[model samples]
Target: MTYKAVFFDIDGTLVNEEKEIPQDTIEAIAQLKESGIDVFIATGRAPYYFQHYAKPLGIDSFVSFNGSYVVYKGKVVHEHPIPEKTLELLESTALANNHPIVMQGAEAGYANYPTTRSIRSLPNRSMICVLRCPATEAATGRRRRCTKRCCIAKLTRNRCTRRPKLRSVT
Candidate 1:
């Protein structure tokens, strides 16, 4: 009858339209945690983008990349990456259509496009790296492929804020 944990989505649930967490929300989370209720973030955002908000809010559990990955108390609890074949197809499709692709890994984010201001605006500014290779290279290990447990493909344009069609690789 009672919930033991609460999961919050980052974009609109935890943070407001301006991407800022309200004081009341912070206090509410604190109160819940103080009451021994586990608070977690369930979002499509990559893990690299969690610390800024998670740390401040004292949330240590996460279901990131739209459930493709999960972490509890700094340890990986679950992860699922897109199949290699699917990744290849997606890469080729994006290239053919000229749709920018942003790959989210357990540790960092990768993009086939050149470094733009929008990519730099990600929560953890330093974690999202611009891939040096062309779109044809895709995720070749020779060029620092995302070696994380889970990788999600995000289809978008130059501006990341634009409605990116999120696709889970797994």
Candidate 2:
């Protein structure tokens, strides 16, 4: 039997702590493509966080945010957005606990508490935008507006890379 496609996790698999892909890995991926295996990225990171890697790795398709969002050949094929009620509950919970929340979407990383140590420690954190919860989205609309999301809130349950599945807002 032969595999037609290969999926790779971004962090510590394709890239190291410094977020750099080794030359050997690049060459190996090139060789895989030469042999006709389609390479794709399957990462917990949001699409915007890892979009830059696509060009170098020759990957056009990916499963991001830990399978919560999927883009096949530059088109979003799957998604699991958090319901509006759930998000509101989270916001209130985080507020009560005084925990910061950092959200991830296809466009950018959104943060509720910008000065948290979690957001400040990152080198590329300048990209994160400080915003309130679900305010920017239209006041009344049937369509949800969000692709992916990550929350750095200090919580004790249901953690996936310390992020909540944020797919859409009211």
Candidate 3:
């Protein structure tokens, strides 16, 4: 309770399993600030994801992507992305085995998979990108909590065309 800085995990600690960050959590962070304590976030979420989420709570420092990157007050303190050679090997293995893959780049990402793949495949790529961005970015966003069931539900619920039933001629 008297710690100088507190590092809260994004998933299941600050945010729900569905990646929903409750308003109460934000209030708790405010209380910490009022107590003169520095609050930080540590999560597997990418920096960009963590930023959006942590910003709401007024958090500035973060250990994101499982510590691959570190950010302090909106400035990048450190970064550690996977090597290009390793990325190539992983992509090759995935392609050879016909498994889905996502390559996280410095400024962009590449997702590779069969078009006939299932909904479960898309998020794997997004998670990879999340690991590359700052932690704050990963803890937030539509892609952060996208799962197979959630994706399917969204697809079903959000219909582009709402057409009325048509009568058939005899």
> Which is the leading candidate under lDDT?
1
- lDDT (Cα) of model 2: 0.65
lDDT by residue (tens digit), candidate 3, 134-160: 222334533343332221111112321
Tens digits of per-residue lDDT for model 2, 24-120: 8899899888999878899877776777787767788898877889988778889887765677686667657877665666645656566657556
lDDT of model 2 at position 67: 82
Pairs of residues at least 3 apart in sequence or in different chains that clash in candidate 2: 81-167, 104-150
Clashes of each: 1, 2, 18
Q: What TM-score fits each model?
A: 0.66, 0.66, 0.56
User: For residues 6-114, could you state the per-residue lDDT of candidate 1 as single tens digits?
Assistant: 9998887899998899999999999999888999999887777767888888788999888878888778788777766777677667656867777666655555563
What are the RMSD figures for all models against the true structure?
8.3, 9.6, 16.0
Question: By summed lDDT, which 10 consecutive residues of candidate 2 come out lowest?
Answer: 151-160
lDDT of each: 0.65, 0.65, 0.53
| Residue 26 lDDT, candidate 1, scale 0-100 | 93
